[model samples]
Target: MGKCSIKEAYVRIENGQVYVCNMNITPYEKGNIFNKDPLRPKRLLLHKSEINKLAAQTAQQGYTVVPLQVYLNGSLIKMEIGLARGKKLYDKRQDIAKKDQRREAEKEFKVRNLY
Candidate 1:
């Protein structure tokens, strides 16, 4: 219902568990009966082995876990998360240039196939 993005979200790791913080989930407009707080922390359901691995990786290296997508699978809601490292300005520029080059190559291939 409102604006929510990665800029407003972050992850918190504590007590051998992972908690997603600062994420907003807006409720329905028609009725406010079953609505909860929008900015509540949502605990992620991960295995013990996975949690330990994530904890170790973050401790030794400067990596952060970020949620990539939230979607429904069957009747359950699933979340996809990824480990991310901050990129410098130069790194970002290089990535952007590479992406543009790949896009151009794909476009050229499509045109060639059409003819």
Candidate 2:
């Protein structure tokens, strides 16, 4: 079975520590037995320079740091963070309409080719 999707995802920074909240990972079958639980959120210990950079970026008005993706890179875990601002309601609606148009176009294309 596939892993369940996370409902609420966010990034939290406190006292120079970064954590990816509400993220879940499957436990490896042949992994170490004494390893911490994979389901629990782990603190990402970034370099001092990286921490300072993220802090500075998030300190600006209307900008917040968000974790876009988290995955295992080789034997180490990695997270991709982005600086993002909240979207307006109209912008969200436009995005939804674009998605619907693209989906409809794909459906039409599939039907045309299925003949």
Candidate 3:
């Protein structure tokens, strides 16, 4: 299902097709030395339907999908990707506003509950 412990990801466009690739993870341990030449390709397992959907998106002129996250799930590693169409400036602003509102509401609720 997975190749190794994935720490990061990168998206690349090759031949007009969008592909997500795994970035090497270097542990920040004292004895460990970071290797810059450790780039390797990792295979992603997805449902046939999902692959078809991604294929369709890639075929489009201005649409591309990319990996958003890669993390450990129990002892297994899982990757999460986005079927993204580039967001407009307003969309980003709206997302920030919504997050701020949610955070403020949570803060108010927590403050009111204090004895």
Candidate 4:
């Protein structure tokens, strides 16, 4: 299914190809018996040059390919990925705090608008 949670996914290079793993794609409601594993690895279709570039970049120490987003272009679906370094505990905590602040601000904005 097109609707999926790619937050837990990471990229892997195998046999000169790119694969995204740990993504959870929701199963189609009506296709109950035919549903595939939601957590299966999915391959990314890219040009040879692009794959080579990604492979080279990810070969660096502590660098990994991260899936940023998924979107549609006309009838074809595309995934956006980038090379990223692992985040430290402090950085993760800061990000969580920022997200919480944004959420609280959004809540306040909605409450003020309800007058």
Among all candidates shown, the one with the greatest TM-score: 4
How does model 1 fare in lDDT?
Answer: 0.82
- What is model 2's C-alpha RMSD? 4.7
Task: Give one digit per residue, the lDDT tens place, for model 1 in 2-94.
Answer: 434445677778998899888887766775677777788989999999999888877766688888877778887677888888888899999
- The true-versus-predicted C-alpha distance at residue 74 of model 2, in Å, is 3.4
Candidate with the larger lDDT of 1 and 4: 4
- lDDT of the candidates, in the order given: 0.82, 0.76, 0.65, 0.91
Q: Put down candidate 2 lDDT per residue, 1-115, tens digits, no spaces.
A: 2353344656777898987777666666677887566557668888989988988988887787777766667887667778889888899999999999999999999999999
The TM-score that candidate 2 achieves is 0.60
Q: What is the TM-score of each candidate against the true structure?
A: 0.67, 0.60, 0.48, 0.74
Q: Where's the lowest-lDDT run of ten residues in candidate 2?
A: 1-10
Tens digit of lDDT per residue, candidate 3, span 1-115? Answer: 2334434555554443444566664434454455343456555666667677777776786566667667787997667877657788899999999999999999999999995
Instruction: Identify the candidate with maximal lDDT.
Output: 4
RMSD of each: 5.9, 4.7, 6.4, 4.5
Instruction: Return the clash pairs for model 4, or none.
Output: none
Separately for all candidates shown, the number of backbone clashes (residues 3 or more apart, or on different chains) is 0, 0, 0, 0
Question: With candidate 2 superimposed using the best TM-score fit, by how many Å does residue 105's alpha carbon deviate from the native?
Answer: 8.8
For TM-score, candidate 1 versus 2, the one ahead is 1
In angstroms, how far off is 108's CA in candidate 3? 34
Error of 3 at 111 (Å): 37
